[model samples]
Target: MGKKKTKTSSTETSRTVTTPTRPDWVDAQAKGLNDALTDLGRADPAASVAPLSDLERRASETAGGLGVGGGWGSGWGSGGTDWANWGRATPATGPAPAATAPDLSGARLEGRGEVPQAASVLDNLSAYMTPFRDQVLAAAMGDYDAEAGRRRAAQDLEMAGQGAFGGSGAALTRSLTEGELARGRNSRLAGLLDQMFAQGASLSAGDADRRQQASTAAAQLGQAREIEQAQLTQARDIERARLAHEGGLEAARLAQAAEAGRMQDALARAQLGQEGELARQRLGLDGAASRRADAETQARIGAQVRAAEQARLSASEQALARRIEMFSGLPLGLFQGSVTDSQGQRNGTETTSGATLGEIAQLVNSLTGSPLSRLFQKKGQA
Candidate 1:
């Protein structure tokens, strides 16, 4: 049989494992160092190269056949793992899901690209107790030592500090003069700041005086306004009292005027009533005059009756006298008898003087038979 062959490292053989990257602390630390070196290159490019080259060499030594990746690899979460099974539980009620079988097969055959990431090698190796002798391994001592790479990287970083100050002797002299000018400018700025502070103090004092005066004026104005308000209230009260008094006086005057008017109307009514009574008294006087006239007419009628009786008596006396003359050759005894008869007739007429109109006419007819007829006939003719 041939001798067993050892697996040569990436330094010796260029072959790399092409699988998903796993957690490897040594390789992560090397990469971190290289990335820091690249960042330094932006500031000073020449200073970064030496440290970067040594990092690459040490990375190859430690992580020889481990192919690395670009992104940060987090672990497979439970939520994504659950989705990878896909619709298995949903289809169990009926027939099995078609997607369920396919998803399961896919997960097994075409493996998901995921891995657990490790921390940096610096975090991993920091636990080791340190000494210069144990830190840098000699070339003959160990097959895997990043000691030489670490030393070269340190030397190159020292070189970078000097590299930041690159160009020459004449520039240094001008830089010194620039420093002096910068100091002179700072002194002038300090003087200006002092002057500004003094001006600010003066401004503050002026503002304080103005504020005090404004405060006093505001207080005085407030007091004056209060006085004016008090006076206005007093005036309003006085006006109200005056209006009330005037209203009472006006009401009294109206009442007195109304009473006077009533009194005048009553007097007029009384006078009118007295005039009506006077007119009634005049009417009563006319009635009295009519009664007197009636009484006078009655008295006149009585007088006419007496005259008629007297005339009848005289007619009887004349009749007796005529009879006596016819017996004139005779005696005094017949004359005496005639006188006695006439006297008797006169007493009878007197007794019948208050007789009614018909009775008086009847008496007159009996006494002067043809005489009253002739008289009535004669009056009618006349």
Candidate 2:
């Protein structure tokens, strides 16, 4: 099999290859210095330092003097800023004196001052100025007697140089070993500083990766929460709809029950109406019976009136039959042999069957048309 070729992103390639980037410690240190300088610029515009190339000659001269001075905080002496080789402090033991008056006898005064021509002044003057000249001459030749003072001055100068080279902390060390380590790139300290600076840069990369991962995780969590909330809201809405449907069903069931109850009531009322109709029919039947009874009573009274009229007519006819037989000289029997006249006389056996129809008609009219029949008619009305 052939060796497989793989591809990688540009960012990974650069990291593995150790491409040039600012060291974290160095970058941090520079950022801090720039910030300080910016603050200084705000406070004092005129006094602000420019880049070395941009500096004026006067400022450059000032930097050189301060940086290379051999006294005070400088390398040649021990004191604050005021210490100098010739001007500020001269030792009392070696070459410095409190009072040394000038000579006037052998020297002539220039301009307007009068001369002092006294031998006594000249004799005492040697005692005062002799030390002064010797001190000046000895200093000029570098003949300092105190080895401690010379050593201190050299140490001070060396310390000040270290401050200038190592940069702005203005480091001044008491030990030669510390100064030596600070001055050059040496074995142990160099290795230690390199490892610390590399770790600092690596720590920055780790922190950046951690921050990116946290952002991605937060986004995912937010999406999950939105989905869960939507599902919950949908479930709640469904439950509400189901409850409303159940309520509607319950209402319908109640309405049906009420309608069935009404139907039952109507059935009961119809049965009662039938019972009432039957009762009315019974009453009508009783009233019809009463009317029939009334009619029967009236009929009976009519029949009795008819019989009484018949009896009255029959009795009157009977009396008439007896009188008719006597007048005809015949017996009142149904048949007789007689010859009869107006009076009661007989000649021979004869049958007088001939009666006057006119007379009988008259008699029946008188009886049938009597006040008694009229009274019966009035009873019929009642």
Candidate 3:
């Protein structure tokens, strides 16, 4: 008898894994965002302000000099002081000087001179007018007297020539002619006298009107002078009041500007401190997030490795079980057979039989027609 040999085999499987990568566009976008954040984090430069002009500088200096009691008045009426007197002028300790009337000596002199001249003109008017009237009357009467004398001479000659000068008719005509001539002379004298009187009255009335105009003009000139003086005094007072008010306003503006500057400085400091604290917090959060991401990645990788190892172990175990079952089903023992004698006679004859290797191979091939059997066949051939 010979011992049968048993064969053991094993198979190894290898797995391929592909790791995914980020696209080019995704990487570009992430780079751009990072650049933008960097730019935003940078500090800004300080801005510059324009210099003040000459007028502004002078105004500022003037305002600064107007401190408490420096000018205008004592302080701007702070605590316990009367607000009504903030920009008021100081009252006089004694009574103010009384306003005096404007000087009118020149006007008075002129008026005096005019009055005498008007009086003199009035006094001489009648003297000059009387002579002029006499001359006019003499000239007018001379022409009439010459014509009357010529007519009288002609009448005498005609009467004498006609020898009627000494007669009754001639005497009567002569008497009537003399009487008519006398009446004409009287009428002309009366008219000349009336015209002279009328002219004198008109001259006196004109002189009176001139005198009245001069007096009225003198009075109006004095009144205008007084009004001008009053206006000048009022203007000076108004100017003083305006200056005081402007000084007070300037002082108040300076105070308000100082307060505003202090508040702005405090606000800027607070903002800077807040920004620094926020930056620190952001750094801490970024670090924490990075650590958490790393931890998660490690956990995922470890789980994947563990799963792969378990699958490999299970496959190896299943292959080993199938090999064990196939080996158990094979008949490896030898068999012996004995032939019985006819008629139950005792005979000493026996037959022995056993399964060969080739028969065992055929039986195993028929029982397992799977890929595992082909794998074994290929290995055996190799």
lDDT, candidate 3, 186-228, per-residue tens: 8987888777667766776677678767766766766666666
lDDT of 1 by residue, 205-260 (tens): 56556666666666666666666666656665565466456545544554454445
- What is candidate 2's lDDT per residue for 106-178, written digit by digit as tens? 2221232223222232334344444544564345333333443566567668767766545434343445535
Better of 2 and 3 by lDDT: 3
Error at 73, model 3, angstroms: 34
How far off is residue 93 in model 1, in Å?
99
The TM-score values for the models, in the order shown, are 0.23, 0.21, 0.28
Each prediction's whole-model lDDT (CA): 0.41, 0.42, 0.51
Global fold similarity of model 2 (TM-score): 0.21
Clash count, candidate 1? 0
- Compared to the true structure, candidate 1 yields what TM-score? 0.23
- For model 2, the superposed segments whose C-alpha errors exceed 4 Å read 1-181, 185-195, 211-215, 222-226, 260-264, 267-382
